[model samples]
Target: MQKKREPVADSLAPQYPIESVDNALKLLLLLGEQPQIRLSEATRYLGVASSTAHRLLAMLAYRGFVRQDPVSKAYLPGPSLTGVAFAIFGRIDIARSAAPVMRSLSEQLRETVHVGMLDGASVRFVAAVEGPAAVRVASRLGRAMPAHCTSTGKVMLAQLPQPELRALLPREQLKRITSHSIGSRTELETELAGIRERGYATNREESEEGVASVAVPIPTRAPGLRLALNAAAPQNRLAASRYPAVAAALVAAAKEIGDQLG
Candidate 1:
């Protein structure tokens, strides 16, 4: 006679997950069910020491799963998790779809590459790839910047309708980020017009003192979802003379990504 299945094995749980990982997942689930949690609460809930909970939260923070409030020291869910929901809902999956393209573009140009998403008046870097060069521009992941002063942002803004663009941007006092930043909405409109005509945009010490970038729009199947790909390097390395080649590389990568998304 064959032995009956063991009662404890009825659930078919995986056998290989580390105990700490299991606890971390449990903690993640707990965080999901609530608005926020403190470190002591995490420690108690995980039955680990304060240091262990801190380390786990640190790892999650690095991976963009959760962020801690500076004032309250409470942890909350992060933006990276939105990709999972977007994927589940059959959305464009921007970061996942653009990651390999960004990597390839960065490798080709030996410059930092970013996939930026525009929301309201801000540009958020959804994905970043670092070049092999030791002195390349730094990654801008998980940070939001004013849209009008960035190459990727211009690529996005140039596609917006005139009414929408006017509604989003202020008429004056456009926060000069640097000496190269567009000083007024009128100037920005002119700059955006050039970007639209050329099918790409360039940033020369606009967002930062020494940074320069070239960017192109990445067409997507999803409606009203504007995305851009950019290659950034130090101003001295990525000069006006190099913009065409860099823009070509970004455009090629954008086409590959758009084809995949389409």
Candidate 2:
């Protein structure tokens, strides 16, 4: 039998350590490293008896921290854990951190600029700055839009692995925000493939009539979430001919925002 390895206590460790809490925390950390864990693997990892590992996993499941797949029977991060991660990102003050970069990009491009975070199948505009031009697109702050229908959302979605992306958008047909929105999962995947190759994404009046946008992903250290920076303008002002330049600007601004976020 393999011997159980104990965690080394440090200066901050409690005077009297609680093994169960320590083991549970270890499991959470393990989840961060892999996509899923089986009961047997957890038992082996915890160096505990099968029943002890089962009980720990059960308590974690009860608290909404982990869930077992009905088919695979492997434990995965649950909704509550995802919620906690978002809460931690919220405390990171992403909006405030991106504000200056958004304002600068808006001014430079003379178009509305936004910082958006991926939320499942949608993208939430966390911060926005409107352009000086009277005809520019309006701010999208605090609004959530279908991920496949907006450049901001698509850019962030492009960062996800294929399995995770498919998990998020399983149906063949997709909801459209406008006539221009991509209509099928296959079509969206095709475009996402191009987005991955080019390192950005675009929308031509997909989310709203007469509006166009280009977006680039904002690199983040966080494991579970992704973000993007976008520039939106009147379609006439942001034609396909301008996509390269607009995407380049968004990329630079995104890097700056990512630095601030860190």
Candidate 3:
């Protein structure tokens, strides 16, 4: 008779304060599930007193794990979470890993291709491939665009945890980069939601008039390294009528890059 297969067991389990950690995780999960959660709601969900929830959130905020809105008085994830994420990404050869794929995509689509990473309030292009087209979107390798405007920036923002997104962008001071730019936190949030559902993001004269772009997130094999691949062209050539094709190509490029990275 064949030997029975043994059940797989979890290794590297923690020894102490598993319950406390579990509670913290539960709180994080709860916050992540909602767009924003009030102190009372968190208290009720965690079965802790309002005072206790406040205290916990305070500690979390101090440690860079969570944040609270000043006006609405809600809680969300903090920059420290992204800090930890970047630490993981630092181990990989990000540029070397993304270059060939970007070049291939640019060649295939005949449009400028860019790879960007979220840096605080902006997305910085880390790699780019120039297309053969005579007229193309001109972008330098180190160009930074506001996260609230560009297609790559929007895609990166969409992948972030809700609280983290809120923490990065408060309700006030969402600027209008162009006439078409999103002017408020609410509108940006709605756009991000749609991007998440559609698996792509678009910028139609949002960052600059007569410039249109399409982008898709390049999921990293490691945590905290939010990256996106984008294709941009002059509005006359890459009009709204061409968005579907451009969006599909961008998504394919992102997936190809992601598979190689993974």
Candidate 4:
């Protein structure tokens, strides 16, 4: 007989000082929901005194569960949360959800397909499927490419608010990954504006020589789920004449993945 699954205990379970632990978890959840939250707001939300909230925040920060911005006095989630997130993601296997879509797109478009997510100032490829064509573009899993020079990165950037986007990449010392890479902030801003308008982005030999790609953002029901789906190929095969059709297919695949996620 098959075994039944057991209910998992909540992290805020009353093993420790229940009030303190609950307050800390509430603070973490609030910070996770917003891009940045002020200390006063946190204290108000927790129904705690300013000093008490500060002490709790200080303890959390000391343990690396959260971080405070000195200038804005705003709190944000720290490395510990990212560590937990990565651990959970490692087990969940987004590749399993994305693989068939990637394979189907690759087969239809005769180009490589990649599923990636924003990581700091870069896009990290989590999954890739190579086309059967002789002149295909191949990307390694876990490869990190600059956000300003890749289709997947631009799609993610387009979704960010101006302040968060500026905070993430203030200066544009964009690397020349290829001759076509955006070399300055102004150029990248232009490209990002276009991406926002079109709901998609493209890279014509911007991340690597002889490679071109188009991407669409994969929307999730909850916040902080950063992901995009892209189709890439050799520049010669993905010329302007062929870009529209490839882009349409990529958009369709992204929509399918988004629907599944929802």
Model 1 ranges with Cα > 4 A deviation: 1-93
Query: Clashing pairs in model 3?
Result: none
lDDT of 1 at 67: 68
| lDDT (CA) per prediction | 0.79, 0.85, 0.78, 0.77
Better of 3 and 4 by TM-score: 4
- lDDT digits (tens) for residues 20-43 of candidate 4: 877777766665555656778777
List residue ranges in candidate 4 displaced over 4 A. 1-17, 47-53, 132-134, 158-172, 219-225, 236-252, 255-262
Q: Using TM-score, rank the candidates from best to worst.
A: 2, 4, 3, 1
Clash tally, candidates in order: 0, 0, 0, 0
Give the runs in model 2 whose Cα sits over 4 Å from its true position: 1-77
Q: Which candidate is the best by lDDT?
A: 2
At residue 102, candidate 2 shows an lDDT of: 82
On lDDT, who's better, 1 or 2?
Answer: 2
Please provide, for model 3 over 152-252, each residue's C-alpha lDDT reduced to its tens digit, 9 standing for 90 to 100: 99999998766678778867659888999988988988999999998889998999889889988886644345789889888777777777788888878
What TM-score, to 2 decimals, does candidate 2 have?
0.75
lDDT (tens digit, per residue) of candidate 2 on 93-154: 77777888888888899988888888999999988889999777888889998999999999
lDDT of 3 at 116: 90
Clashing pairs in 4: none
